[model samples]
Every structure is written in structure tokens, then in C-alpha cells.
Target: MDKSSGTVGVFTAADVAVFSVMLAVSVGIGVYSSYLELRYRSRALRQVITGALLINICIYMSFCLYAPSLALATVTNLSTSASILIVGTICTFYITIGGVRAVVYNDVPQTVLMFLGVLIVVLLVCKETVGAAEVWEAAGEGSRLEFFNMDPSPYVRHTFFSTIVLGAFVMLYWVGVSQAPHQRFISVSTLPTAQG
Candidate 1:
């Protein structure tokens, strides 16, 4: 996809297959972790889970580091790899000092800003293209807004069953295993406060 225009986004069948497989694997790992937590109640298993989560966070952060470099490289006419390294180093240093509390606290404003940014972009796109109706018309013409596909083949890119069922499982796994949200749920100091 082109980073500058934002008009080259494309997802092939192979992309869908890879995404589905990765989602399935993530869900499976989350389930296994939950089972281990419940059955054995082992501290070692908890530590392992924590380590795995940290590794995932680092991988995500690496990707995040690269994303901004795309824009910075275009703006400054510098090498993308160099921009990525600079941004990544700064991020690594910030994360090392900031820790989990810092991450959690920053997420609120980050989420808000992201939503506002998307809203602004969508509004601008609609304005530039004349209206939102044209956008929907184009999507419908391209058959890109399908609500359901009854295809039963597992190899199919996107079926109703695959979207609804697999999507739910993926979300459930994310919420169940992710430490940031989980910590918020358990942060109350009192049972009454938690219940409330």
C-alpha cells in the first residue's frame, strides 16, 4: 500500500488466509495459557505468559516504529531505514523508562487522538470526493460491501461464518490475554469498588 496517497490498500486471498491463520494461532495460545493458569496455577506458567506478552509488545512496537518512518522519510527525503532506527531508538528508551503504568496512562489520549485523526481524514476524503454517497456508491459498484458470503470452503477468503465466528474468537482471545485491559479490570482495591 502507498503510504503517501493512502489509496493503494489491497488485500488478496493470501493475505486473508495468513491473517486468519495467525488469528487462529493466537486464540489457541491464549486458550492454552488460560487452561494452564486454571489447572496448574503455576507461577512459572504465569511468568512464561508474561514473557510471551512482552515479546509480542516488542514486535508490535517495532512495526509502530516503521510506520511513522514512512511519513518522515517522505517529508525529509531521508532513508526510511534511518528514520526507523532513530524513531525506534527513541521509542525503546521511552518504553524502558516509562514502563507499564506509563503505557496504560498514555493509551487513553492516544486512542482519543487516533479516533479524531481518522474522523478528520474521513471527513476530508468525503469532501474531496464530493460526498459520502459517492464513496458508498463506488464500494457497492465494486462489490466491496458484502454483508454475508455463504461459502463453506475453509480456503475461501471471507465467508460470513469466517468473519463472524473467527472474528469473535480472535477478539475474545485478545481481551482475555492482553495485560493492559486485564490490569484495568482487576485494579480495584476493594471488592465493593470492583463490583460497583
Candidate 2:
């Protein structure tokens, strides 16, 4: 007997409903914009979409910059809100001045640093423990190593089939439909270069 009502795994029904509405709205906007482009041959709608997307990016980036300060504040016993404000302001200043090219350039170094940090943590964990074999054993015992579950039920989450299907859909949407990737790809000198 489950104690939780209308909640499945990490998401509640309300969460699903909200996301569904958001997805519907996004699809509706995209379809409308495409129709306007095709029928009217007007770039005005496209400009509006671009402006809205830029605003969305700014808000999303602000949150991304602020999130790390929560952990930093907890560790240092400082004010999380102050840290977030400082970090967010600095990020906003750079983003406002440097623009998308700056973002693309920064992403490479940020990705490298993230991977290096993960490697260091893994090395430290292995050093303090019995190593990879023991870690694997523990993970297996905790059912964390079940990577090949091929459950065909839609109700079942994190199954191999669901993971593959969802991952493919997400990748397709992000690469083909999302404005950010579309803009980045087209910003290249030539079509062949962008395709490559």
C-alpha cells in the first residue's frame, strides 16, 4: 500500500499536468510561427519569437548561475541569497556584454573543469574505499547497477526501452527544433561546415 497520493516516483500528477500544458503551449507556438512563415512570408513573428527566447535564456542562465551558491553558502556558513545575488550579477554582466559567442567559448572550459572535478572526486572515493570492485558490489546490492531492464510497460520508469525512446526524442527536439542549437548551427560560415 503506497502512502503517497497522486505521486509517482519523483513527480506528482500536478507536475506532469503542468509539464504537459507547457509542452502543448510550446508546440502550439512553434506551429503558429511556422504557419506564419509559410503563409504570410513575414519575419515579424520570427523576430518576436527570437526576443522571447532571449528573455527565457537570460532567466534560465540567472538560475543556473545562482544554483551553485546554495552549496557554497552551506559549506562556508555564509548567506546563500547574498552569494546567489553576487554570482548572478556577475554572470548577467558578462552575458550582457559578451553575448552568445562568449557563452559558446566559456562552455568548452566549463565542461573541461566539470569533468576534471568529477575525476578528482572519483579518485578520492576510490582512495578512501576498497576500490572499483567493492563500489560495483555495493551498487549491485543496492540495485543501482540494473541498467538492462527492458520493461515494456509505459507505467514503469527508467527502463531501457523508455530511456532510449525518451533520450532520442529529447535529442531530436533539442537539435532540430530548439532555437539555441538552430541559431548556433546557422551562425557558422557555410552550410557544409554547419552540417559537419
Full-model lDDT for every candidate: 0.66, 0.65
Candidate 2: which stretches are off by over 4 Å? 1-63, 187-196
lDDT for model 1, please.
0.66
Highest lDDT, which number? 1
- Tens-place lDDT per residue, model 2, 1-196, is 1244633233344533543443334434333245335433457755675677679778876677667888778788679888887777887799789875676667768999999999999888887899978878888899888778889998887999999999987885565455566444434445554334
Clashes of each: 0, 0
Candidate with best TM-score: 2
TM-score of model 1 (CA atoms)? 0.60
lDDT by residue (36-151, candidate 1, tens digit) is 45444566775787689789878976787778988889899789989988787877788689754566567768999999999999899899996999988998999899877899
Q: How far off is residue 59 in model 2, in Å? A: 7.1
**Candidate 2 weakest lDDT stretch, 10 residues:** 1-10
Model 1 / residue 14 / CA error / Å: 35
